[model samples]
Target: MKKIPVYLFLFLLLAGCSLSNVQHNEELEDAIYLIVSDENNDKLSLNSMTTFDWDKAYLFTPYSTQESITEQLGVDFKDPSDIDWRDDIYLLVFLDSDQVIQYAELERQGADFSIGEKQYLTPTDDIINIKHD
Candidate 1:
């Protein structure tokens, strides 16, 4: 009976330790604003969009620009002047204090987007709802 209680306590202790690993991505802890914009320059705030999958989104390295990110992803994105903003979308995540614009390219409409490392994907319904004016 004494051994049974000891083993049970050990199991609970180990379980708690494992649960510590399941946490929000530390990189996003200071995020204060998240917005999505279209080619038309229309903006929508996603700070209220609770269901967004932060796991599928990753921040680009600091000082990243459109040209640098395009080269990194091997994607031939259009020049800023050439792009028809009305047809496409971009997601921007801004951190606190400094207010840096974390660049995000919508790789495909209603599909997945890949940056240099992580894949950005949101539920199709969420995209549809947010894309509306």
Candidate 2:
């Protein structure tokens, strides 16, 4: 009947909505943070995952934080943000702690980064290690 078809369409549309209904903590199962090592090999803890600066990719540091750059690495593991650290530096992407690397590639923009998001991940492996790359 027409009533049945109309109800089905409405249900499908509502299900497809992309708006977030959960809090930030619920969105991220594990806290995300970045570990940065400066040119002098001084490691810094950038408590946020800031976006990559496509514009200043090579000019200077990508991340500018209100917190001092001298702040030591490693947070309490109960924080989340949208900032990351970059410059003439090396970056390590950690999920919860230094032991677990979310991005296992040695280099941040390594070749493994080219793999499709879904294809590069396995449900059974919480952490992935790329050896051949």
Candidate 3:
């Protein structure tokens, strides 16, 4: 009976450690964000199921090669470091509940703008119209 109790305790301890590791991995995974833009450089879109109010738009970081910011955005982005257009200016589009969108520019820092790992969070709706220049 004592041996049986000892085995049970060991099994529980191992299970707890495994669960903790899994949770840590999940936290790391959630820390990245992917910023996707079109060829026109109009707006950046994210495949996220979570909806945000118009007021929350400013809180989002523009898609860029910055690994730290991208990580905090909870996106999995591709490494955008090697691309030639690293100096190019990029815009971020914010959409409102009424479908109205706004734009903001992202400045380049040398070859700093690289896309990181990409993971799809949710399905995004198609664009209707983009008015910015």
Candidate with best lDDT: 1
Clashes of each: 2, 6, 19
Residue 36 alpha-carbon offset, candidate 2, angstroms: 8.3
Error of 1 at 13 (Å): 1.1
lDDT of 1 at 113: 23
Model 1, total clashes: 2
Q: What lDDT does each candidate get? A: 0.36, 0.27, 0.33
**Weakest 10 consecutive residues, lDDT, candidate 1?**
120-129
lDDT of 2 by residue, 76-115 (tens): 2211231244432222333332222222112333212121
TM match of model 3 to true structure: 0.22
CA lDDT, candidate 2, residue 93: 31
State in Å the error of residue 82, model 2: 15
TM-score for each prediction?
0.23, 0.19, 0.22
lDDT of 2: 0.27
Tens-digit lDDT string for candidate 1 (1-133): 4466888999999998864432333233222223222433233333444333332222233234667545534444333322233234333332222222233333224322223223332223212223323
- The predicted structure with the larger lDDT, 1 or 3, is 1
- The local distance difference test score of model 1 is 0.36
Task: Write down the lDDT that model 3 would get.
Answer: 0.33
